[model samples]
Target: MNGMHRLLWAFLVAAGLAGGLAGCASTSSTPSVGVGPDGKVQNPVQLLGQLPLPPGAAIRAEQSLIIGAGDNWVGRVVLDVGRDFDAAYRFFLETYPAQGWTVVSAVRGKNSFMVMTRQERTATFEMVDGGMLAGSVVSMTMAPRNAAVMVPKKP
Candidate 1:
């Protein structure tokens, strides 16, 4: 992680996302994602649903942190995709554009990466090959495009 990544992590942590970070490792039965039993929207589903995810992707909530709401949210979402590095990497390359994200950079390797931007936000995907037992870990970090800009000081 770089300075920007550290800053974003700090922001999310400060925004009270740390509380939601728990229970991601617990397997206890809980309400289904997206909606509660009352039929209202749930937080996890609301946030994760906005992204273009691979089929059967399982979220690793312990390793994820999300802030904001709707289409303007920014944070990191870690997922375990049941595919190899190549397949998982290709999924983003194809799906991001269909969802209006413009691919600015992509690298294919043992640990692949892709950076995409849309509207006022940018997203970076880090795909680490966990191999057969653990599968792949896809860490997607999103932030505002102007979040890190340093305006010139007026003399």
Candidate 2:
């Protein structure tokens, strides 16, 4: 009788452990970003709008740019949206430049956004701190949109 009781107790403990681990694994898995009929990863902004955010969670966009000195030179821009440092960092790395502007480097902290660019000149636009608390920050810097070239005009 004593042996049978011990065996039953051990089995129950094992089953409980397994179930707990499985529950955690499923919860931590990344949410799938389904591909559209066009076979491209769906835009995260649109996706976020559709789903409910985690409790106390908020979303916002941060834009940063660095332009190298010179005409028709390299430029960098980053757009990030997330509270998780790792997720925000990954988002900038995976998204930027591909949209148009070049990307130099991006580093995200629990409450801050950091980036470096070196296309023609280097410039940066980041939140004073990681924008994770409550407020939001957006920044941008670039060459004049209508500046004329310094080259001599042909007769």
Candidate 3:
């Protein structure tokens, strides 16, 4: 090929590579479909809402998790509800027992905490007086009662 044709070919090759790289520089956090049809972040912690939370409680979409596997499951769910400290605390106090949990400990006041255990599982929740805006926040964590701190590594 002639020198001019070679120069033009090089320019075209460089432009193609630059365009490909520019396409890679996406500004979106997600590759596609960040929001569902409902306009909320998809793949949310659905486990939170599915748990036996009281009516009107709103689970914090992010500050929740599910851990462990099968019969050894542990999890946490944080909720905000337009309810006073006493009522919310009382709900947990009463709810756990009806579900067959034995109340390990219970306290009542502005910021109260309760611990309940059933079989090999333990559940604990702390009720704060107020949230950043609404009424109160209940943070609850559930785990196996006698979970080992650490286990030996498998071969």
lDDT of each: 0.72, 0.38, 0.62
What is the lDDT, from 0 to 100, of the residue 27 in candidate 3? Answer: 69
- What TM-score goes with each of the models? 0.71, 0.27, 0.59
Worst-scoring 10-residue span by lDDT in model 2: 61-70
Task: For candidate 2, write residues 31-57 as lDDT tens digits.
Answer: 454544633334433332222222233
Which of the numbered candidates is closest to the native, going by highest lDDT?
A: 1
Candidate that beats the other on TM-score, 2 or 3, i.e. the better one? 3
Winning candidate number (TM-score)? 1
- What lDDT tens digits, residue by residue, belong to model 3 across residues 21-136? 76569564422324345333343333333246665676564675544322333566577756566667777777768878899888776778888898887778888888545589
Ranking by lDDT: 1, 3, 2
- Global lDDT of model 2: 0.38
Ranking by TM-score: 1, 3, 2
